[model samples]
Target: MSTMIFSRTDETPGIHGHTRDCTGAKGSSTLAKLGKGDIVVVDAPDINRTLAQKLIDAHVGGVVNTGAFTTGNVPNFGPQMLLDADITLVENVDPELPGKVKNGKKGRLNDGKVYYGDRSIGQGEVLDEETARTRFLDAREALIDHMEALSGNTAEFVSTEAPLLIDGLGIPDLDVDMDDRKVLVVSPDPQLEEKLKSLRYFIREYDPVMIGVDQAVDELIGHGYRPAVIIGDPDLISSDNLRSGAAVILPADPDGHAAGLERIQDLGVGAMTFPAATGDATDLALLLAEYHGASMVVNLGPTLDLDRVFDTAAAPGTPSAMLSRLRVGNRLVDSTAVAELYRVSRSGGGWLWAILGILAAVVVIVLIAGLSGSDGFVDNLIDSWNNIALKFQDLFS
Candidate 1:
């Protein structure tokens, strides 16, 4: 019902920047703060798919962004996600309008104009599904042009000093039984709940090792699963989860400090710090599992959507995440397929139940024959049943 501006600039062109309705936080953080019926005025040059997805999940009324959705800025699928969610996304809005809005405040968008506290300040162009489609295609083409510049060389995505950074970066020395074990790596993605439900049987049957990444710890506990290890920034994870007896792993900052270590230190629980890597917490968790020699890794809520190229300094195509997967190889199984495999395993026991049912039916028929005093008929039925059983056994043999 109201508008909030996301900006980093001192002042938007033609509009005042120092408004109470504006947020200087990044787009994803801004979306996290805003909710349903909120209007997000993105003053940044581009929004990533992660933030776009947040806006969609928030069920926001609309997004009035002043920045262009170029290949370098916007995530590839950001525009499509907004369109599919039917969230009104107005690109190339008047830059000045965003600054007019307040931070943590409400405003309205109507008739190509933004209104804050009942006053119209600036105009914006509304992007429909068709327009979003055209924009996404153009962005893809531009992305290809940029990729051509790199000549498909993935080595460029990694720093030459990566080997130095990773060498001897203190990883967790905790011993985990990886022999024929199913290790479940969980992420804080929204689809995690559904995916966890599908894996319930496998979880109960295999009793796999659970590793929660960041906010995924909450999901794991909420779903009645205890994480053997929780890794990530403590700010995103709950205090209870951190104290849940799980070994904590966090990215060691350049200063050799980890954000999560401070939270768990007072509890007398120890934590291991690894050198900060390119990908987010989920990637780090996967790498940790691989390092520990997990027999099979089941990933839930992993970032599989590769259609993003935000304007931020974050690398496109997620080389670090890809590298983590390559490290794990065929041992990595998606949650959906894992659930199917578990379901099939459970169904395999159905024949035993069917045979039991047949035995019960035969007993009931024998009782009926006894009660009716039909000895001859009962004897013939028994003979025939015995013959049938023998024939079945012979067929199997």
Candidate 2:
């Protein structure tokens, strides 16, 4: 038996995605937190791939939620990760079931019902490993269907949003010289993060402009750099970073209601809003960079992957994104290919080479002087060389 705990869904007033409400206090601030051998009851309609994968990573005993635990509407790696981890997942449980599960109560899942303190809180369908795998395959099939539908309508959508490219003409008070500059747009993806870490050599060599999308600003901070520009919904960004002087870009709807407009304006920060052209904030960031004459855009963590399209917000935009990529072409590089293209030896140039060059010249001059036939020159050179060798020996010692 494992300890049981309850958490609100993303729809809950204050719960962020896959939040943990630790410290025993329940409010908008408390995220749901649990550990190994603990059963977590959540109110979300579906266990999203990210959360499901996280539970598996945390080694949780089991999960009880109101919805199924596939990739939701798109194809993603979450379901596959969960299946591989072999964590217990039960879904379609009643929302009120968590309440009936008293705190500190011991619970166990048998068949489809969760029993706590000899009482059955609710019943659900257990998602075995094979079922999870099947769901992932189905989600990927749906993504293919979505891409096909979008490919069918791409010419239409591109025609509609093509004029919107002019909308990226400018932000009210921000100025950036994007011509011929490499721009790195970061999104909050674990794989992207790891890829970025591995490409530090390339990053140092090029020093591309860093753009953070929403919560990815924090990820940028974690990597020892601050974003030059932060784009997307303002609510997802921390006030401290927003005030750190990065330009903000918002995605606007046709109705003129822009995501994060009020908050950004309330903070008195000027932001440029472009009519929503793509699905997720990262896509919007890439569009902004490309439209503004960026010479090159390197994306870390794009949702263009088949597994990535499973996110609800990303699924619809999958088609639009395809068109956007076609427009950007080789100018847009994902993190995966950065190493092969930009990675090079650090000794190519810079101060390190300058110092080595100076030392080499000094050694050459000394050798030339030593080769002189003059007895006095040879004597002085021998003494100086002996002194230098002694010094070198002392230094090494």
Candidate 3:
């Protein structure tokens, strides 16, 4: 059984099992460290449980969730799974209790439990079932408040560039478009690279303009697609790609480290340098593409979730650019969707695997229903199965 020790703001005083070390790296690295003992601290219900499950599946000992077991939205499925696996589960550290006694800052919230620094806090007294229920609600409210605060800051930063974005719009030229052009967007991560490769097939079929956002230029280069435009502050992307004849967009801020602007000027590639403000330039690039005449812009490995937004914030700018693209409607295609659409091939092996999966699923359902002696379950399964079969048959026939 895995042991998960965490602290919550809702617990009573003097709990020893609710806290964990978290001072060095407060996020993923801290979580990774906890994996050594199979003991993990999960304090925020607003934290993506999908991410938590990914950690747990990697053999994390157990999760000590601070909030409710299940608040319906970001369900506690991962924690529940940890419980079902007989992992140690505890919650509700005293919210008002002093957590880490760091540098004379002795009084702090229960969230202070998961630090790698000296000093320690523990889970408070375990509640009876009814008190646990009430504390769960309190935890849920605390989580909500945290989420709202984070979201507000994100929204503020995203909105900072709205005016410039609005002013920069123009009618897009459609005639110079090349049909079915393949483009690749590069990122440092292998997962992102895989996602881009999957999305490329669809974009290739369409033959639209391929715009590489930042390091995605390398991704395109590796896959044999020439990037038409490289958009970003030059710090993350190589100045070489810009100097090597690709068009570059430089952000306006000197601190934005709009590198390669001079090279772009020397190379005479059409470049636009915008003020380096809070919003993302990737969003600017998408908007620019639309203004300049891209029929459809497909994003490869763009940030799409809250956690990603947080991660991306560690980069130079706000993710307002991606958020702006969201408001752009059908003009932007999320690369993840494209990847899913193109992941399976129409060739022999692909069709064979899909058929086998469906057949195996059908067999399992039939066997399970038969063993349960539930006519309703079997009947519903058959009815749904028949409807699917009939639709396919009709289409083919």
Deviation in angstroms for 89 in model 2? 21
Which digits, one per residue and each the tens of the lDDT, describe model 1 over residues 278-370?
Answer: 437777777777767788999997455444322223345366566667767899888888888877877998899899999999899776654
Ranking by TM-score: 1, 2, 3
Alpha carbon lDDT of each predicted model: 0.69, 0.67, 0.53
Off by over 4 Å in 3: 1-162, 165-189, 254-270, 306-322, 345-397
Candidate 2 local lDDT, 1-397, one digit each (tens): 9765954232322111221322123512222345566666655443456566556766766666666665446545654565577656677877667556654455666566776434566888877877767766887787677767666666666676766544543323347666678998998886756777877887787888888987888778877877788887889888778888777777677456787777887888877875654546776777767876778899887547644444446546666677666667779988878765544444355678889999999989788767764667678688777877999999999
Q: Between prediction 1 and prediction 2, which has the larger lDDT? A: 1
lDDT tens readout by residue for model 3, 236-263: 6655666656656665652445566666
Top candidate, metric TM-score: 1
How many clashes (backbone atoms < 3 Å, residues ≥3 apart in a chain or on different chains) does model 2 have?
11
Model 2 alpha-carbon drift over 4 Å, by segment: 1-148, 152-156, 165-174, 306-314, 340-397
Quote each prediction's TM-score.
0.56, 0.52, 0.49
Worst 10 residues of 2 by lDDT: 14-23
Better of 1 and 3 by TM-score: 1
- For candidate 3, report its TM-score: 0.49
Poorest lDDT segment (10 consecutive residues) of candidate 1: 13-22
User: Which RMSD does model 3 reach against the true structure?
Assistant: 16.5
